[model samples]
Target: MKRSYFSAPYAVWMVVFTIFPIVFVGLYAITTRRADGNDLYTGLANIGNIFGNEGTYMKVLWRSLSLALQCTAICLLLGYPCAYFLASKDFAKHKTLYVLILLPMWMNFLLRTYASMGLLERNGVINSIVTALGFKRLELIGTQGAVLYGMVYNYLPFMILPIHTVLKKMDQRVIEAAQDLGANPVRVFYKVTLPLSIPGIISGITMVFMPSVTTFAISGLLGSGNFMLIGDVIETQFMSANNWNFGSALSLFMTVLILISIGLLNRMDKSKTGNGGGKW
Candidate 1:
């Protein structure tokens, strides 16, 4: 059969939008301003500057990784059960529930984060409720906990939706056969359901982890300028510090980190499913 040319436009779009931007960033990262006000190829000079400032930058990188890990863990813990329930026969019959699960995502993410900001602020709704009950007002905002909460809240759906998709599409007979073979519900889940869901879980982890690590808006709004993440630093380097080269270098480092993470996750997925096909 002759292949259709329908993918040609999308290939062009990918080159223009994705490939071009990456190449541009790479160029910016490697080029530096010379003494005569002209640009010169620095080779690894910009990367060297990143290493020189490794003290602060590494600290920020660690914090970003830690928070992103926390957020991803929380999302998996919370989303897995929710997804399993929603994918069950009972809830699958009620499609409206799925719509409701995705309703918050339909709204603007910035708006949702801003609304979360209000709820977590010093004198926000929670504080008001606490004071109403004669308890001390809680200072939730501008803390690492608050940032972590914002990360989970924003990215939880990313974790849930993929897992639900996998579970809903899973073959029922595999689970039934396991049960028929004297497997209890828990054993069936561990041996059959959980193993089969590895692909979805890995995908969900990628979705949650990447955004959580790279996000600046949630940290900025919730942390109230108190916290400084790598994303915030990159933004400051470009916007406030007027250091595009450094920003580009940092962006390159971040991209490499994300790629490494994705590679590791893919390796784990391949080990679980064997042959890298993710098929049972």
Candidate 2:
């Protein structure tokens, strides 16, 4: 009973910060005001505008999803091997390496991203190196590639850390038992390690994908305002266009989309494990 009391403050915080905002946004999204200044609920009108014949929102959504997926994929491909090495017994003596890996995260994320801008800009560090090496200077900033690069750079640690935690906590006995059964490294990994690591991979994917999808800073700074993402649109709607109702509508839609994606990922994880996932 005392433990229940401990949760009261947290519950109150969630109600105030989370639930209230969602409820307010929903109210704004579904209701319209008449000439008499009375609000009327209009079902799906805002949604239809988002997905109707205009197709502008649809394109923005697709672009966001595509970039998010690409960033997630890149993170996974890079993070897995790095995590594997860090989690290996051979490197157990070097705990400092893990701290070094995490050192970048201690710095402000925006500052780190902004620092990358300096390195990537034309005639910056990279371009200067290329020029000195008798190579053509490459245009690095204000391109889709630059935006994608920023996403990968900023979010890669999110992918690595979770998987590293999971891997470090994994039971070594299972791995040894698999080895005792004469299973080769490749076979054991595919048959056991990889399957067992699905939870971490799912966590990593969620961490990387969500922010990548909704990020405005990376795209705005690196993309030079050429690309328009759903986040950018939402910001513009509220800030520039003064369309609070539409912005609320967009936020509600994005919340739904994110929930759906998380639901699907959870379902997939559950199907693989047959019980959501086993406790560590």
Candidate 3:
């Protein structure tokens, strides 16, 4: 009874902070408002508008998914080696190196996005360097590549930390055994280290992918509002258009999409574990 009483506060807090907002948004999504500022109960009207309007929302969603996947792939490709080096080596000042990796995350996200803009613009340092080297000036800002670069830069730490954690926890004897059995370093990594680090890969992928899909600040700051990612769409609908119903509907759709993707990934992970005969 005492424990139950103690847990009540947390349960009430969850209801107030989490569940209530969801319920409120859902209710708002299904209501209609007149020009006179009176809201009327209009079931499914907002949802219909979202799907029936030439699928603009869906296109934005797909763009967000594509950007997120690209960012995750880049992070994995770049972070794997860095994480492996950090985890496998006994370098001087190793802790300092890890701290440096984490330092970017300590800064404000908006500031980081703006900083990326400063470095990628027409008169930016990158352009100046390219011109100095006698290469044509590249349009780094307001391009898909710029958006992707921002996403990767912002989320790389998330990818690295998870992979590093797994690598650090790995048993060194496993590698030694493979080497003792005449296995090359590459072969040993593929057969032993790579297989053992699936959890970290999964963790990193989820960590980077989820946030990248929902990010608006980077796209706004770096992409110069030219890229219409789903997060930006949601912001526009709610804040700019003042269409709470449509915004709520889009938000709900995005939330559902993310939940479904997470569910599918978890199922795939379970299937892989079952087939591989390995436990996470």
- Choose the strongest candidate by lDDT: 1
Full candidate order by lDDT, most accurate first: 1, 2, 3
Give the candidate number with the greatest TM-score: 1
Stretches > 4 Å off in candidate 1: 92-94, 275-280
Candidate 2, 41-66: lDDT as tens digits:
88778767788657988998999999
Question: On TM-score, who's better, 1 or 2?
Answer: 1
Clashing residue pairs found in predicted model 1: none
Candidate scoring better on lDDT of 1 and 3: 1
User: Clashing pairs in model 3?
Assistant: none
What residue pairs are clashing in model 2?
none
Clashes of 3: 0
Output the better candidate (1/3) by TM-score.
1
Q: Model 1 TM-score? A: 0.94
lDDT of each: 0.89, 0.87, 0.87
TM value for model 3: 0.90
Off by over 4 Å in 2: 33-40, 276-280
